[model samples]
Target: MLSDVLRSVRLTGSMLFLVDATTPWRSWAPQTEAFRRVVLPGSQHMVSYHVVTRGRCWAGLRDAPPESFETGDVLVIPHGDAYFLANPPDARASYGPEEAVAFFRQMAAGELPSVVPEGGGGAQQTQFICGFLGCDRRPFNPVLASLPRMIHLRGATALDGAMRHLVDFALCELREPAPGGKDVQLRLAELMFIEVVRRCLTTMAATQAGWLAGLGEPMVARALTLLHGAPARHWTLAELATQAGASRSVLAERFVQFVGQPPMQYLIQWRMQLATRMLAEPGAKVSGVAAALGYQSESAFSRAFKKCAGAAPGGWRRQPSE
Candidate 1:
């Protein structure tokens, strides 16, 4: 199941970057009903997400009021542009910038507040851990393009256990004194974000009733597994259909229905994504990566890669690394 997800994901982009909210740099307590902003000028703009670990908060997006968040929940604010993180819904449109900065400083100094007031309803103090999720915006990032502007993950549900573990692990890594701990935490956060998205995709059919509905199908899941398990293999409709336990015509129809593309179409896109990642890795070579991904020759791989990435493999190799 995981293998398919990985393969399906590669179709959109090659990299996943994570951030640990529990990092000492992120600890904060709301004082004056304001939202905290975490800016990532370097994010790819495909998606920006947050995972909650310690307490509750709200995320404000354009055209939407601030939404509530709780521990173990994940909030995806696509297009990592500036947004608001507030303690109360009413906190929007009235926060003072100076006071917000002062609150950030106070939290940095270990100040704690009790009884955070809620807007339009109740008053309560809320604590929260948040992080950023980064990914490419292209060919296969179906989740991002189809998702709403703001999403709320309900904590205290069956899905909370793994997500909570992810949050805690992220926190620990962020706080670790070990060398490169910060980098490790970020990578883990990216993985957690992908997992959280898949989990949400699983439930979206019931609650969301939108573009993610196809992701829940058994056949679609099978196809994803095959592609992820062997990106280098030469896949044909017949072989894919056989593996998926469906006839070619049926598989084609179903793949289109659920995955939003023909099986072979998805395969080509997925292969290019994998190639892009390999090209980006420090020591990888185009020829070696081409062979690994089942290309007959480097030239063949280069042609396909250029078609998708708008640059030849060698040219991509020469470009600045991400």
Candidate 2:
């Protein structure tokens, strides 16, 4: 399920560069609503992350409590809300949110230097690599919807031996640039994010809710696997419960408890997600897509798609990019 969701919302072109700042420095990441189109116009979501390599700093949502991050810590803005990183915790940024938007535009356009020098040029310094990844959030991305606004992960606990070594190697590559470093850095950025999400899944509390949490529960996971694995099947509560080794009522209750929807409703949305993917593919016919998704006819699929996506398949396919 996670793989399918991730496959649907792949990380697109990213702008990654080293941040070198002295003491008394603060940087604000403008909200995605303000700069998502500006920085990466066609992208549906903007994700920003920072890997602390050299020094400690304070980072969190703009209005959230300040969290301390030391060397090797990773601060991630998965939901793309405004955030900040500061050396002295209260250091004033020289630029405001609008100016930050302009900075992102220039940075994303490849006009800025690789090593961005900021702060008051004090003796003490903090260094981290700032990266921006673009992905889609629409047509049903369960993983994206399940995540919190911000994530702060400690390298010590978050990284296994192999991932830690990979991070070290990637950081070393970034610190000392060589030929093909750009490609290496981009892949490293993507892997680091995947690792963080993996850690989050493993450490999730039993009380947590949402798709990821549902994956941790045996009953919920079994039903979800059945639905995601064979989405085209005509599954009813009785059949799903019988196959998952649960009673119909119990299965329905637990499915709603974790997934926030009835099992059949979930399937409808998942089918629409798959339909959108097919509709966007080159040479995809609505009739074939509907047949493949277990719909009785193309009109049925179109009605369902319009209900979920608010546009007919043809209209959506021909719609201009955002």
Candidate 3:
């Protein structure tokens, strides 16, 4: 079920670079939103990550105090927010979006993977395996919407072993640039992102109250599994509760508390999200999509689609792109 949600979001990972910098090294990696077209074109959202493969560095959002990241640490910016990386946490270095974009463009234009000195040319050494994952934000992106802006995973747990291996493999491929290296890095990045998400889910506190938190509850998780597994099925509250091993009232109360919506309401929204994606298919038809999503008629589906998406099904399908 979790895998299904990830697939539905259309995750694609791309390698950015393996940066080896000597301090006084400082640079700002701008928000992915600023260079989405150039970096991960066509993605609705971008997630940037850095794996500290060697030495140490200071990393954080531009306005906040920098957090020290050592070798094997993974720094994730889930929202693709702009952040600063420097040797000295408080170094007043300047790296603007224009400069960053141009640098990336040049890298994209056949630059070899090597240690490029950051504008600040100091002697301290720090290395990073940098990359980005692109995923759909439209229709639905529960995992992305639920995560914190920044997640720093220190490599001290079992999960870190697998993540480190992925990073290491990708880093090796990038450094050597063998045939099919790009594909290998991309696939590894996707797997690493999934691993990171799984790690987060396992460690998330029970007190949290978002979609991920909802998935942690026994009854709610069962209900979500059912909902995701069969989005096309016309499921009632009683049916869902029964399958979730709970009574209707209990399921309704807990589901609403954790998911912030009644089961039926969530189902409707989920169905609509699925519908939008289906409708975008090259040969998709309104009637076919309507029936597939449990709607009895095209007009009914249109009404529901408009209610959720602010546009009728036909209109939405006719749009240039989602």
Query: What CA root-mean-square deviation does each model show from the true structure?
Result: 7.5, 2.0, 2.3
Q: Residue 46 error for model 2, in Å?
A: 1.2
For 237-284, candidate 2 gives per-residue lDDT tens digits of: 999999999999999999998888899998998888888788879999
Regions of model 3 farther than 4 Å from truth: 108-123, 205-207, 320-322
Off by over 4 Å in 1: 1-47, 51-58, 68-73, 92-123, 138-147, 168-188, 191-195, 205-215
Better of 2 and 3 by lDDT: 2
Which candidate, 2 or 3, would have the higher TM-score against the true structure? 2
TM-score of each: 0.68, 0.92, 0.91
Residues 1-322, candidate 1: write the lDDT tens digits.
4434344344222122222222112222232123222222222343545665555666656456667677666676654444665554445444456665564445323342211222333344444444444354543455565576666777755236667677667656544435755456556656676666767776675554333655577776687778767877888989988998999998888778766678787778778866766776798988898998899898998888888777898886676423
Give the clashing residue pairs of candidate 1, or none.
4-224, 4-225, 12-140, 18-186, 18-190, 35-85, 116-124, 116-125, 118-123, 232-293
lDDT against the true structure, each candidate? 0.58, 0.82, 0.78
How well does candidate 3 score on lDDT at residue 25?
70
**Which of 1 and 2 is the better model by TM-score?**
2
lDDT of 2 at 73: 84
Q: How do the residues 1-322 of candidate 3 rate in per-residue lDDT, one tens digit apiece?
A: 6687787777887555778777777867787767777866656788888778888998998767899888877788998788977888767666667878877666644454534556466767888877777887766577877788888877674236677677667767777777876677778778888888887777663756667888888999999999988888889999999999999999999998877788888888778878877887899999999999888889998998899878888887765432
